[model samples]
Target: MKLRMKSLAVVMGLLVLPGCQNMEAVSPWIDVGNQVVKNAGYDTDSKLARGIKETLYTSTDRASTGLSQVGAFNLSLPSAARPVADGLRQFGLGSYVDQLQDAMNRGAEQAVAEAAPVFKQAITGMTVNDALGIVRGSDTAATDYFRRQTEAALRLRYQPIVEENLRKTGFYEQYKGLLAAYEKLPVAGKPELDLERYVIDQSMAKLFTRIGEEETLIRKDPVARGSLLIGQVFGGAEG
Candidate 1:
């Protein structure tokens, strides 16, 4: 899976791209790459799935730090809601919240890990001609295409796992406790949160977002491809 970095580095300089962040501006190269992808012997779908899975690993690591770890959820809420939440969390309510969240995160991590094979298999319709569609379409087109094609299947596959994890985490009980505590305060308003749905939806959204970014990077950045198959498909275009 080692890509030709030195060659790619030389091409990157010749392409006049500023940095990895700037690759989106050179999407026209997608047109060039697409032609190569079609004629290249490797499967673009497999490469894409692997890249996305790798991206998911990196993304979920970051997300775990921000969303699944201790006090992670507390920092992300709106300012108006923070003071009351902070006061309660200062007492021991936050421990339950963090525990529930950590459970959800662990579940999501498992689901995402399980999803790599599914993602690869989901692209069953990925013909050689599809490369052109990916090139002509927007940055998120691959993600959009994949989701549009397999969203229903993905949900069916992921929901049960999410629900099971939530149960294991005691999310429902914690949510009820949190809501009751909120309702007890004379000044506290009802927070109407669907905890189960929130975890499921948020996990799916983050997974997809990471996948889309991986798709974009594979199409745009030489270094990000990280595979001989990827480089062969995309390298000859700019080489």
Candidate 2:
């Protein structure tokens, strides 16, 4: 009986010892990081919407180059609309340049509004596999996927609006002016600017930049760890 009691005491002592307790390390950082990604993706969608809106409102150039005949016109006219005609003359176009700018901006704004929700859903639904693939692929692969998936549907939805805006804003007449100007220029092989496509591409590029920023944070920030798997996979310390 004495021997058995001594053995039991030893077993109990071993069980109670801190090092023998088989404790696992718990990391809160991963969870925090995941939540941050989700939130940032959502926030990025909002920023995308705002950026599109601002770009439309403030943009004077149909090409979105920030410097254009329209901007020059605005500066020259200052108060009156006469510089618009002068701008057309400088470009050797007709009186339709101003109208084209308006039409392009309107189309861009509408396209962004229609596409924002789809983009948000895509970002929020991104899986670990998707993130990993993005990390492994080209710098813009994630953004490219988002664009590929969304562009067709968005273009289909946006085309009618763009067409209507173009007609309403007299884009045909504006294009005539542009064509006239183009004919006078020595430059050849002028690439056609598909306004809807350009707007969508630019927006996707911006969204990718935002997603990449969040991803970088997830990779670097220990406090953003949101899961046991993530902690186990990424955390260097033995649990």
Candidate 3:
């Protein structure tokens, strides 16, 4: 009885614990948008929006190619730094993890392209305060702001697109099968991870990394700004 109770306790704790592999690590916004700019009193063609659009137009395409390639996620800092949870790795689903990781990158690759217009529209809502904040903030400052404000919005806007694309590729089936296999193991406990949320968050993170890289480059070298307005706005920062 004690042993059974202890196992239950462990599973419950794992359920509640927050980490990448743990369910909660998927982000609250997952469990948790379109009129945002109109509500902010800025139209799609607003100056802030135009600036962001231009910046993104120049960068997003290149970012897509660079980041969407095979092995991209494995090469990212996030992969190395993200904790995979002891239980997940101990289950020894190494090949499953590899395939899942590849699927995540593939899903994200398309997501970035599909999300471009949404992100561009989202830029229309950026306020002067937001501009000042991003300019004065870190390299990924704008990306951070975008995540805070639009992750939920983006999720709503982007989820269907990602779902459709992944489904067509059989990515969803593969991921579900692997996860189901894992969960069937006597010691696996209830599956704690949300593969959809994990992929979405990772997609945004990688795109943000690309954006931050561009932002940092623009800040350091005048040539990369792609426009006078962006240069004047973000050029002074040392990031």
Candidate 4:
């Protein structure tokens, strides 16, 4: 009996030792993940700025296609805001649309160019906890957090630019024309169209969507798998 008890104790100790070490190793990953998320969140402005730049550059290439479909010289309109290389068949803007598209693209390019460094600086100021939450949450969580935190400030900062872009792209004029037509209709309770609000909402939605895509890629792709601590705490390799 004495021998059996001693043997049992020895086996239990061995088991506990490995378990403790495993737990310790796992703890650091959580910290690392938190740090990464926080960093990502803080840098969201930069990321968004970069995304805008890419979008604009790509849009420039598709400007002609947009024009052919719209028959208008306004690109800042909702119709021409479709993603690039995705075809311009849907905007239905009619002819001269290319001019609008090009101008819109140029304005977007300018806005991003002006905003990128500001966004970068903002991101650099994010806290570690903020980063962790973003890193650990859903793919779009970080972007969402950034938007929630910075939207007000960003709007204040970018509203003038958006207005300028709208004017430059002829959206301001076209929007007024549409509003005039709408006002003449006998419609009741027509919601006022705030162009600035609409543009900001649309731009933010697209930006978040792209961030979510990146998050999905990070979660599923083998190449990006190494970026997160997958198998240890969250479950084994199978989990």
Best by TM-score: 1
Cα misplacement distance, residue 167 of candidate 2 (Å): 2.0
Residue-level lDDT of model 2, residues 1-239, one tens digit each, is: 67655543343232222211121222233233334434434232232233222222221122222212232212111223346557776987754655665665565455445655555555555555554343333433445555565556666766666566667754556655765786577877755344444444544344345544443333333124223222222222122
- Residue clash pairs of candidate 3: none
For each candidate, give its TM-score against the true structure.
0.55, 0.40, 0.53, 0.46
lDDT of 4 by residue, 1-239 (tens): 67655543443233222222244444455444434534444332233233233322233223323322422222255533345213544556443456544545454444433544444444656665554444345434545665565556655655676678667755567766876787788988766455555555554454445444544443343123322122121222221
Q: Write the per-residue lDDT of candidate 1 for residues 13-67, one digit (tens) a residue.
A: 3333333343455556644543354444434444444434443334334433344
Candidate with maximal lDDT: 3
Q: Assess the local accuracy of residue 101 in candidate 3 as a C-alpha lDDT between 0 and 100.
A: 57
Local accuracy by lDDT, each model: 0.53, 0.42, 0.53, 0.44
Instruction: Write one digit per residue (lDDT tens) for candidate 3, span 121-141.
Output: 667667655654443355566
Sort the candidates on lDDT, descending order. Answer: 3, 1, 4, 2
- Give the C-alpha lDDT of model 1: 0.53
**Candidate 3 wrong stretches, greater than 4 Å:** 1-62, 68-102, 165-192, 236-239
